[model samples]
Target: MPLVLFVDMDYYYAACEELRHPEAVGKPMIVGTGDTAAKMSGVVESCNYEARKLDIRSAMPVAQALRINPDIIYIPADHDYYDRMSGRLMEILKAFGYRMEVISIDEAAVDLDSMSYEQGLVQGKRIKEEIRKTLRLPCTVGIADGKVLAKIVCDSAKPDGLKLVERKDIVQFLSEKSADKIPGVGKKTAEKLEAIGIKTIGDIAKSDLVSLSSAVGSFGFELFQIANGIDESRIVEHYETLSVGRERTLDATKDVQKIYLLLDELSEEVYREITKNGFRFRTVTAKARYSDFTDKIKSKTLGYWTDSPEILKQTAKALIRELIEEKPIRKVGVRVSSLEMGNKQMKLF
Candidate 1:
C-alpha cells in the first residue's frame, strides 16, 4: 500500500527566531508585536516550545502571555525572513522527487507510492533528521496509509518526533481522536458535530452519510469520508489557484477619471498579490456594479502570461471602459485569471 507522509515544522516561526539567537534554543520566547510594558498589548504570532510549556499559545494576547510568564522573550514577527526560509525548505522537499502538497508555510504532505511501508518509515526518519541537522530546525513526520491519518499522527508527534500508522491499524488509530481531529472540522463544525452527539472520529466513520449530508450539506459528507480514512486527495508538487482578484463596494460615482483611478489601485494590489504568491496570468478582467445593483464584466486575454502590474492595469482599464457607461458606479473590481505556476522573471538578450 502507498504511504502518505506528512511533515510539519515544530513551532515554525518561533523556531526561526531561535535559529537567529541560538542562546534561546532551550529558553522560552515569543515572536509578536507586543511589548511587555504595552500591557502585553500585541498578539502572539508564534511561541517556542519553552513558552508552550507554560501554556502560552499562538494568537494569545501578548499581555496575557506575559501574565503567564512575565519574563517570556518577546520579539516581533519577521515575515520576509520566514518566507525566504520557507522557500528554501520547500526546495529541499521538492528535491526528494515525491508527489508533494505544501499544506502550509511549515507543513507538507508527500506520497510514497513507489516504496514499501517500511521504506516510508525509513525515509520519514531521514527527512526529520536532515531538516534538524541541515537547518537546525526541528520537525515532525507522520506516515500512514491515508492523508487524514498521516496528519493526525503528525499532530500527536509534534515538536520533533515521528509516528507511523499502518494500513491495518487505521481504524483503531483514529478511534479515540476528537471529531476536530479531521482537517476541515474547525471550532464551529466541531460544535455542530458534538451537538449531534458525533464527538469522535469513530462516530463520524460509522454515522449515516445521508443524515450528515442533510445536516451540513456537502461538507458533512466530506467529513464522513475523512473520518473513515477515505480521503482521496492526491499530493501535487504545488497548489494551483483559480484566480487572483481585488474588489470593492464604494460610494456611488460616475466620473470616468475617478473610476480609472480605482481600477489603477485595484490592479496594482491584485498584481502585487499574485506576484508575491508566484502566479502569472494571461487574462485580465474588470467588473462594475452600477447604482441600480446591476453588474457587468469585461475580460481581455493577453498574448502571453504576465505578472506585470502595468499590463494588468491597462488591460483592466480598457475592459472597464467597455462595461461602464453613464451608470453611476457603486463597485469596481479587477481580476487576473488563467494563471500559470511560476513567478516568471523578465529577461533581455
Candidate 2:
C-alpha cells in the first residue's frame, strides 16, 4: 500500500513571470505571445486565471487571445528560467524522501508510501509554503492512494489549493464529477461513453466491464479501474522517457549537405545528453518540419544499445535520405530513445 502525491503548479508561466516581476502582481498575464508583424501567428503558452477568464489560453492563437483581451500582458516563453526553478524545486522534494516522477514541466507525482497521509499532508503544505516564500511560485498539492486519484485531486485543487483523497473517499468524490475528470477520458471518449449511457464516473464504475472493454479495447478496462479507484501504477525511480531530442529552427537553406551538417551537430548534442545521464538507447530518430509546419519522424532501432554520436548520425542520415516527402525544411531534430541504464548489467526473475 502506497500513498501518491501530485504537485501541480498554477499557471506556471504566469507564476514564473510574477516571481521575476513583482510589478506583474494582480495583473492579467499571458505567456508565449509575441508582438510580431506576422498576423494570426504565435501561440499562448500559459495564462493567469484572470487572463483565462477572458478566454486567453495556452496554444491558442495569439490573435484570438487578443480579441478576448487586447490588454492581456504577453511574454515569450522562458524555458531556461522555468528549468532552473524546477530543478531547485525537485531538489527540495527529493530531500523529503519522495521518489519523484515528473509528469510534465509543471507537474509531478511523488510516492510517499512509508509516510502517513496526515504527515504527508503536513509535508506537502510545508513544501508549498517553502516554494511560495523562497521561489515566489504558487502550486497545488493532492494526495491519494494512487497516481490517477492523486491527479484528479490535484486537478480539483487548482489555483493554489490542497486536498487529499483517501481510498474510502474515492467513490464519493468522483460520484458527482464529469466523466472527463478521469484521466484518458477526453471529449471524444466521453461522447462515445455517453452513447453507451456512461456520463459520470459512477456510471463508468458500474457499467458492464465486458461491454466497455469491447468498445475501447484494453484502454476501456484501464479507464474502468480509474473510475473505481483501482489504480496500481507506481512512481518509478527512473523516468521511462520514450525519446530524448534536440531541435533547431534553422535559417532557410536549400543545400541538403548543410542541412545534414546541422543534423549531425544536433545528433551529437542529443547523444551527449543521453550519455551524460548514464543511459544507452536502441532507437535513433530524426524529425524534419517543413516551412509549412508539416513534419515527419523516421526512426530505427539497432540490435544493441548505443550512446555514440557516430552511430546516431549514421542512422539519422539514412532516415533523412528517405524523407523526400517534405517541402523546404524549417526545423530539424535528432532523437534517441528506448533508453536503459548502461551499467545495470544484471538479470532478475
User: Which candidate number maximizes lDDT?
Assistant: 1
Worst 10 residues of 1 by lDDT: 340-349
- Model 1, span 1-349: residue lDDT tens: 3579999999999999898988777889999852333435568999898899999998898889878888778887665466557656666776787877777778888888867878988999888877877788889999887676788899988868898887778777787889888887899888878777888989988898886876677898778877777667676554433466777767889888988998899888877776766778898889887886666889888888877788888899889889877889988988777776663334222
lDDT of 2 by residue, 1-349 (tens): 4788888889988888877776667877777743333325778888888887776678888778888878776676655466557656665676776667767657888888877878978978988897787777899999898888899999998979989987898988987788889877788888888888888888888887887877666878878888888888888655344356777778765568978999999888777766766778898878776766656889898998877778889999899777745377776877777776676565332
lDDT of each: 0.79, 0.77
Supply the TM-score for candidate 2: 0.75
lDDT score of residue 116 within candidate 1: 80
lDDT of 1: 0.79
Worst 10 residues of 2 by lDDT: 32-41
Task: Please give the TM-score that candidate 1 achieves against the real structure.
Answer: 0.71
In every candidate, how many clashes are there?
Answer: 1, 0
Cα displacement (angstroms), candidate 2, residue 66, comes to: 1.9
